[model samples]
Target: MRFIFLFTLISVSFLGFYNCKKQNDLIEQKIVDSLFYTQAEKSIIFSADSTTPFTCLSALDSQQLQILKKTSRNVKTNNDTTNYLVHRMYRTLFQNQGLTNLAAPEIGINRNIIIVQRLDKTGSPYELMINPKITQHSTSTTVYAETCITLPGAYPANVDRYNLIFVEYYDLQGVLHSEMIENQTAATVQHAMTHLGGGVLPLTIDPLAFTGQEIDSIMSDADSIPMRIFLTTIHSDSLILRKQSIDVRPDSNDLVLMTLIKRMRAALATTTGVGIAAPQVGINRNIIWVKRLDKTGKPFEVYLNPKIVMTSSNTILFNGDGCLSVPGVNGRTQRWAAVGIEYDLLDGTHHTEVVQGTSSTNFTAVIFQHEIDHLNGILFIDRIAKLLQTK
Candidate 1:
């Protein structure tokens, strides 16, 4: 993942037009005159570009004067999902011209795009079009200190923007309109897009690719652990992953799963342990190790072949999640706070349940989803974007 330098290209004709701006007209240069660049602020990725209108926003949206409000637009339960959203936003956004090359990214995320400089029919340096989300909004906008990953190790430029921007966007169906947002949400949306070229706003270029950081390492007691019932217990080393689903089941995979249920019953002697998966014992399987968190503190009731069916549109992102497989680490993730799931128990019994709330912390969703990836042979590390991420 490379830091995409979107505005790097300039047509020979534009060089005539790209004369130096007057001192007072520059965003970063203006900040420097204030003598406000602190040591910390000077060592980050931060900058801004000019604005290019996509839809000709209504210059007369009366909502601009109101105070900023908050919403759940960009909050995701895990880095994987966050990365997914950012990546798609790029591919969907197109320009009228200026694309010299369009190679797809391997560790792809479309949120931040690198626009190539190309000549239009008139032989002038014009940007391909850019579509940016309204990440922040309020009736009144202000720009503040901003950073970027592309221009690494630079000073943050103090800037101002609309307290809230009523951004116009489309749904899966393509109908378009605007939305208002406040505070950090608004700022983040604007900052990520400025890196594309034109529509100059204060955004920091992140040469760094992935967005996740290593909050901490998960700890484990030992390497090889116990095997569950319904499935045969294999070592993590023994598992062969192909993609994101389960590739192999044990000789008596169903029995191995049942054994997990029995263990849940035993572990439930005092409280619910619900279900168990092979990976909990150091083996990786697409299977789950979950049991409903009993209302009255019942033992964990085990289930097999669990699948989420119906779910509400409302999702939440929170922190402090842990996982049994990737031990010693916990962080935030985006998950459907409430989800409906239908699955089968070990005894060939089918169960329908709705996880109306989060499994645990944001990290819990990461872990559960991580385990699901195991079913298809996926890992958390593989999905991480190189930008703004930790080890």
Candidate 2:
């Protein structure tokens, strides 16, 4: 993503018109001095246009965008702290505009905003709308610009599109700096309008976390029965079992996440399974509890947003690869002998782990691949089918 920097300096002017008998009231006017930073050009323009209102003025970078998309708003982290501050700034701006009860809109830099420049009637070049409505309240100076573009959607209605941009400012020493935060869209604003159940706060947090009723049902079930498991035998459960899971953000609901981890561990303990995924528990979230046989204590650990980034060329064929969800089924499946995994912990820390070896010496790598496959909506039986097809 590209960055579009705009440093605006506002000067208020009052002009009085004299009539024949009396002096007319003074009219307040605002003049905006805008400076844009780009790789190609850098220029300053003085604008008197007060008709247009800026749609959004702040944005998040690509990394912050990913964090915003993946992580929920329920959990607190260092990144979340930064995002919260930005959100507060937007909230204040919206409130000042009489747009109360609105969620903070996500913003990001658009590629077009970097290259395209629009000229007004006076031939003054302006990349974004210069609205007098936008007023800066913070002591820290802000430098950012945004443009809204409307695109045709698949349906009859047109989709409003806004390219996201990150906001940064210059300090007293003239050093450019930014705080990491995430962004939202206009669609998100509309959604928030309809769903005001969360009040003024943005409902960016994931709602797919396990409900109390669902949790009670799973916990109360017989130890031998996998009540929470979404089985291939069941038609409704199979739908979720076949779908890809979303990443579990570091800021996911702590109570929900801990409950899931506990229930998954309990479910795994019921059987001889080495690992259990959220999909197996009828939740399509990127979470897994795996028994780390390679570790000294051979403990079970939970990995959120786990992904198998790399695999060894050498393959291992397990004669009886099985699954808790696919009970009564065991088939030969080929898996990587070694695999590298990237995952996150509950504390918002990231880790990369490599597990390798034969099934006899270490089955951790195979287990990792199997669980991560579930996150991608792949089943061990599917692997077995591929093996049979090759034969």
Candidate 3:
């Protein structure tokens, strides 16, 4: 009788311990699931493929849902779906007028969870990774999660942006998790994408600002400028070469803008020039292509609506200030040794950069001054003439 009682007690204890463990695991899983789903609902909703429509989670308010609906209609009208989606995504996600700019969505997982995924222009999915460390203290659980996008590219093409999300949840035990996903094929394709000149050039033009005839004229003029040719004073294109170019407004025709950029870059490549401006090709818009000697590899970059906002008191007389517009004239022009410029990229981001260096080492400052002068209807020879007059 004593042996039977002892065996029964042992069996009861083992069963109780096993049941307790299973219950605890169920509670922990409930906490994790609640946190992950709730956080994902609060985050930006992304479509896995182009055919999938953009959606909003229940966490979004009615106003946000309405905004998303309106944006969706606008996106549908655009022919270039990928580019339009990218533009609209940035605007809606970061700069929506009516929407509050919330922090990036946080996710807590004992293992790994897919927070969000996006399809690139080429229809390849971008993978996201989140690393979270969860700690439990008595009744509450705290989670620290960091998110990163594994860019589809090789070394150096890979870019890391951190601290995008943070997660917290309660009633869960301590758990640590980390995961990494890499795609070399995607990365290589993405790396190639960076070389494709510009980003998100809007196609629609403001009809109110451009009459039908004027639009046709501008388009024709832009198309007439061949990729291999530079409009020069030697070719009787003096009116355009000497005119002060207008600002490239948000309402500017994107087709004209893109055509001018492509043709100007092509024309600059034919010469030994380090920079070329839109007026040099007879279009007369505030645009320039400059070789950034300051950057690694000396990549040629396009700047829209470039303006020199500040100049150093010190000046350097560049010995050979030549131009593609004024071909036969090369003169010593006084240029600022360092200059601060306010310019816009093709992606609509404004940047104020201060470039400084001598004629030999970093010639970027001189390049800025020269190209901006073209936009202002001034040439290197004109600058030399002014210097002579002052002397």
Candidate 4:
């Protein structure tokens, strides 16, 4: 009787622990569902042929990494899904399964890292170890505008911004009231998302702003006066509109390209930029220079003659549109808001054109207009619908 009673107590304790864990998971899921900006779904790692999502960060701990590595070893003898770590695996991957076969493949990638598994769902792999860091404050408040949320929902993509800025971004879809934050608001939002996405916090700026209520004093700076350092003109072999060139004479074309590259890097540097045009330098040439996204931000691609095949009715006005060729001057110009440009990516061997799209918001549009205008001997000032009319 005593033995039976002891066994009964042990079983009950085990069941209780499991049941409590299951309940906690459910509650956490519900909170994430209700709160995160994007919907929750299972994610897989980079290169395995499986579709099971690594539902949460806790599921992707270091033990999982060890399991995946072992499984990778197991699959080396027979299957295609067995080995390798690739880009897609770096995030929790999501896809459909069961289409391939009854027996599952043995290896896979999880969390942008590698993995090994006996079966997709079974076995414990070690997680890549992670720890939180506390950084010293550079600014009393780091400014940012929230563009995405992990708590599945909609949010704004673009907002007025400047680094070391105080600004606000909206998410009316969640948190019934628009979240108001500053300093480390971006930090908090990103931190919360780590659990939602099964990843470590990618350091970033704060996405919230302080109104008069939140901040007693906020600074506003004046725009720099415009200057024309590069005496450039938009001259065209106008009719064909095939190509325009900017005679980069004052500085070596190489130096010219280098300087522009530096300015772009210091201001807005993203891999999204493909090339900068000659008209951008104030000479209308069918000339274009491009640099591919690399470990470094340099324009590596160049096009001597380029063409545009399609256009958009959307018109945009970039508030900070200024010219590298023209110094210190920026004003509003009206141009086709977006264009699907066709040009060669600088292989020098292949001549192909695609509908490269542009919008009014970015310096990209300004750059394109600057280059193409040089093709026609035009400058941003000539297209200027509004120059800062002096008082």
- RMSD after CA superposition, every candidate: 22.8, 17.2, 17.0, 21.7
User: 219, model 3: CA deviation in Å?
Assistant: 5.3
Q: What C-alpha lDDT values do all the predictions have?
A: 0.37, 0.51, 0.51, 0.34
lDDT of 4 by residue, 194-297 (tens): 32243322322223212222121111211121111233332332222223343321222232333443333322222233444443422233555443333145
**Model 3 C-alpha RMSD to native:** 17.0
Candidate 1 Cα outliers beyond 4 Å, as residue runs: 1-225, 228-257, 260-276, 282-286, 359-374, 378-391
195 Cα displacement, candidate 2 (Å): 15
TM-score per model over all chains: 0.30, 0.49, 0.44, 0.27
Worst 10 residues of 3 by lDDT: 70-79
Better of 2 and 4 by lDDT: 2
Can you tell me which runs of candidate 2 are displaced by over 4 Å?
1-24, 28-227
lDDT of 3 by residue, 304-389 (tens): 88999999999988888888777688888888999999998877789999987656767899899999999998878888998889
Question: What's the lDDT for residue 325 in model 3?
Answer: 71
Model 2 lDDT at residue 246:
87
Please give, for residues 163-247, the per-residue lDDT of candidate 2 as tens digits: 2333343322234444221223223222232221222123222254444554565556544444467788999888888899887
Ranking by TM-score: 2, 3, 1, 4
Q: How accurate is candidate 1 locally (lDDT)?
A: 0.37
Q: Candidate 3 — which pairs collide?
A: 152-186, 152-187, 153-187
lDDT of 3 at 368: 90
